[model samples]
Target chain A: MAYSATVGSVRHVFPDLKTVLARASPMRSGDVLAGVAAGSEQERVAAQLALADVALRDFLAADFVPYEDDEVTRLIIDTHDAEAFAPVSHMTVGELRDWLLSYDADGTAIAALSPGLTPEMAAAVSKLMRNRDLIQVARRIRVMTAFRSTLGGEGVMSTRLQPNHPTDDPRGVVASIIDGLMYGCGDAVIGINPATDSPVATIALLQMIDEIRETYEIPTQSCVLSHVTTSITCMERGAPMDLVFQSIAGTQAANAGFGITLDLLAQAQEAALSLKRGTVGDDVMYFETGQGAALSAGAHFGMDLQTVETRAYAVARAFKPLLVNTVVGFLGPEYLYDGKQIHRAGLEDHFCGKLLGLPMGCDVCYTNHAEADQDDMDTLLTSLGAAGCTFFITVPGSDDVMLGYQSASYHDALYVREVLGTRPAPEFEAWMQRMGMVGVDGRVRELPVAQHPVGALAELREHAA
Target chain B: MSGAADDAGAGAGASAPASAASTEPTEPGLRVVDPWLELRRFTPARIGLGRAGDALATKDQLALRLAHAQARDAVHAALDVDAIRGALDGHEVLHVRSAAPDRATYLQRPDLGRVLAEGEAARLRSAAVPVEAKGGPAVGATSGFDLAFVLADGLSPVAVQEHAASVLRATVSALPGWSVAPVVVATQARVALGDPIGEAIGARFVVVLVGERPGLSAADSLGLYLTYEPRTGRRDSERNCISNVRPPVGLSYEAAGHKLATLLREGLRLGLTGVGLKDEGPSLGA
Candidate 1:
């Protein structure tokens, strides 16, 4: 409990992740090196596989069960003693909102309910009771604690740089990186989706992200959105394996689509952790899912896509992934076809994922062939931004050549920040200032001459001085 | 979507059996339209289902979920090859698996799903030409069979287990005396494996009946992929497809076979297949 802290209403761990670091025991990464140095070739090989299997099996189920105490749940229960808050219990939503505004204007009491209820849950439950509400609750949530590699040592809203490249085109990849970093993005992870399934092609993409990170000194993680097996291969082969990525569903068949088993997932976790990939401790995995994937995988077991999707959070949370996103409209209609459906599904996924205590984000997007337009994405983005979403996909001009769809763009992030008053992860915000992307007056600057290739070094240095 | 509706039913009113009128629109401020109910047609596609506030109505939600479950079941369902062969009683059969080791590997590594297991391929390759040639002209004299009907469980094995035999029966009936090779039943297969299987078996042309990815409402849907001078590495553009061979609602096996037979005849005559050749099965009145 000493490792935890409260920000507004939700409780979060101050989380140095000592337990995770300590558990890298029994098989210290050093043990493998030692065995290889001190044994026969076959013994060394056996030692390696044995350690790998243990690491995979060590995927702790405890992580998915919400490690922090549900303090907000207690607050929600306390409010149910209608006699305690009877003065406002019979009032209408708007009136209750206004009354709470006048009474607890700073919103401390109202913010306390946010971690307990997502927007949809709040909407459905607060119908009859005036005192019980999340419309008011949402307006007050200030601090959120989410893991994104080394980014969250405290509480904040964060966004990742999903600069997906078709065939890992370096120029296109670099352009999106430049655009995202300028707009104060990538506080979370700069994950990529590779065009080819080949493990070699995937490693090449991770190398690209690594080079960019080293050159710019960006304090974030990078990933090639390849399958987990490929990612594990990259880590083992000494490629930059910051976040191991995979697509997961609620059933065996869906999980099979990515060649994953419980043992495989655990192995992937152990593999990444063995490399000590995270500077912020064991938050190494990155998972993406769409609504109908469970059904698509033949593993829904009679549950709806939403419930099955929610169940996938258990898979995600198990490895303590730094980011878990729902690529909502990716599956197309017949599952969730139009913009309205996309918006509703996005909110539901975000709310459900957050309620289950994962760092939830939404890919506010539409395929060229889907029954959705940019306006639908607008609705989804704004709603999710207002509801404390953790991240959104931003590509160059919103067209992902690889995935062949349009998603939220860099400008959309600015729009959410401008309209909703949300800020990027604070460390990222500081970097934005240092690079002169956004200035003291809270207005974004043109990409500073200093940050451009054409800008003269002496001139830029004098300008800075 | 069906499951969502059931959830809505459970959430809005658990006791209502026949009518959802209790939770029906009382407030005139909004009206939720049941998209399908508004129309007077049958469609596998979901429509007209109105919203419960901003989400799907209870019935629509439950229906969607139900469709989803059925679709999942369709994909995960294994092809009952023995049952299929039994249904086509006394027919000689050849069983094969794609290079993919199992269902999981097949889904992830599709490249593996497009070829025959090496041993099976080699076995077919080594078999001598048929001793007897029957039906039509000798399509390929070097390899004595006119055709091989390869059955593959592509995305949904349910499609193969439920509909492939009936369709095969319809197909065989249509082509009365055509010299067909023993039917090749393949597991963990994709459409292109028809090429390797056909070439190995020494067939001049191949008709592959495989399962299509299950749609929300239509799970047991069968599809036919036709190829000429079949071999490995055939592009999708080079093959003609006769799809959605589900019972009752989709194309009947008789009709599907007619279309496939038409394509085979046309493709053989033209000495080519795929995009240039179109199915005039309807006009030809097979």
Candidate 2:
């Protein structure tokens, strides 16, 4: 194919947005001609980069669409390393363009520039470039590919196994976890919402999950989604606590359900830290939130949903949460109302959360009353996975017996792992391999479902029969 | 760009961004050729509508404004008792209202939406309907019926005006051997209002079909709530809610009615309605 045809084939998908894309396309620059004409590939690439800088003047003059409160751009600009990035600072736009072109195949070098020049600064400079420049430069900026930065670490997809029990009974809990982990879940964490609100019940439930992890020698985290006070009480009482769990809204008032304030959140963090339970790392807060929470809690102050949702991230960042999920469809239908809105809200929330620097997760779920079905959640989950979502909640039959709604299933997690090349967190991945659930080929095994009524239920069934 | 391109290309339609935070090209008034225009001709969902400067074109904006007005009007619109009565072929009917006297009050104070009018509760209290031996009633035994329904002009009266009677009349025949209470046609009422009316009528099972909040795509949508034994202060989990009742796009009235009938029949059989019961059992194809 001709060069124009090759690019045009990609452009044909969004033919209407051509003009908008053209502004971003490096093809609009003839400076690549220098590369095309040069004697060596290296020199040609250099010439192309030089021309990209020459085209920067046009980008500086081009009219652009305005963003409302672009925090990403601000971060890049705010953290520019003038001394370390003197190479970038002193170079002309043309020279800088060539320099960035050189790293098109190298992610580590691209990541290295973040501290030296800042991601926000690199992003700001890239903003002025054409589409070709944007795509070329954008492809290289992968961060923390080797280091496990608290989240399932970089370069892998993960899920938190949420095996909720109606009574938080060991039987129900054990059955669901066996099913989920066998299908290769719990890479992110194995969290559960306690059926009973009592601290004793909640603590027992936490211990139960912890015991299972120990029994199987599973390298995963456990959480009980009762109030933070319950987790804190358990921590203080020497219970096996992995992640401190809470439901946070955008504002203090919205957090009333969790009985949370920044101070209380801080106190909970201190308490959880005192427990010293996180074996992997100290980052152990798990917060679940949704869009209309602030507005429903009467703390929106008329701010837009997406804008207000980002503020919740500030709270997440404060605790340095291990996982932050926006339960987009769990809120009432009045807020999201339908499949399309739910899908849009999930993406917007993910984008905003990821931009605000959090390992964002989504409960791609809906209720019986909602106009949405599993299909909508699938679309959102697939999109989020491609966009680098860290985790999601899994259910046994895709239904939360106690919470009374439906979410992603164990089937969904296996499907994500199969399709997206995502896996449970790295440490957990090794455990799955050791257990022979994960193949040497890196595919999760389709293990047969465990017979339910195990643990307490098994004894009851045995006695009754 | 044609209106069709807007819908099909929403996510796929980003161009190379400008130097600033601008996502759109600097060019103004120049139209770009749209590839998804043909695909866009398929759905009426706000796709592919061309843009004017920064906002929607005049025609699109006006249509949107019109839809907004229509939805608002549906919320504030009053119930037509005569039209409703004309549509129904029921056992009996009683017209009452919620405590919120007007639409404005109902919008502002949701607490009032849950209760019946001052004398309305008394009417239910006073009206004694005979019942079968279906484990008696949970609340008002002598006053309530075996099963009751409250048709409320919830968020959108337009939905009730259009769908309620047709749906109820169709579903009634499917419900066999049960002594259903007189249908309560309520004004400015919410789901919980059915509980008090059911309590007054001494109903064992209650279902409320009310107008759902309108979405940008569908305005005249309806919602239904089914409770095994409903009463005041009952939590939402105690009831099984079925929503998005409309036509051509949403859950059709017939399907909604069938689902309601199935839940009620099952609830009566199992002596339950809400949490712990799954709708997965014995699908009535509702």
> Worst lDDT window (10 residues) for model 2 chain A?
A28-37
What DockQ results for candidate 1? 0.03
Cα lDDT tens digits, model 1, A45-114, are 3322222222211222213113243222222233333333344344433354354446563435544433
What DockQ class does candidate 2 belong to? incorrect
- lDDT by residue (B59-106, candidate 1, tens digit) is 754654464466557666788888988987867777899888976556
TM-score of chain B of 2: 0.79
- Over B1-286, each residue of candidate 2 has an lDDT whose tens digit, in order, gives 0001000000001111111111223358754333223212221223233324222456655554454455456656788988888787545678998888876556534567888878887887656555544444342234346678788887777788898887786566666555677888988787788778777777888888887755333446777788777789786678887766777566776787777777776676677878855665464432
Q: Over the stretch A61-168, how does candidate 2's per-residue lDDT look in tens digits?
A: 322211233332232334444455544555544465567677452555544443444322232234234434444443343312111224534446677777665455
Q: What does DockQ come to for candidate 2?
A: 0.02
Candidate models: Cα lDDT each: 0.58, 0.58
Report lDDT (Cα) of residue B127, candidate 1.
Answer: 50
Calculate DockQ per candidate and list them: 0.03, 0.02
Query: Which regions of candidate 2 are displaced past 4 Å?
Result: A1-152, A449-465, B1-92, B95-183, B187-189, B192-286
TM-score of each: 0.50, 0.52
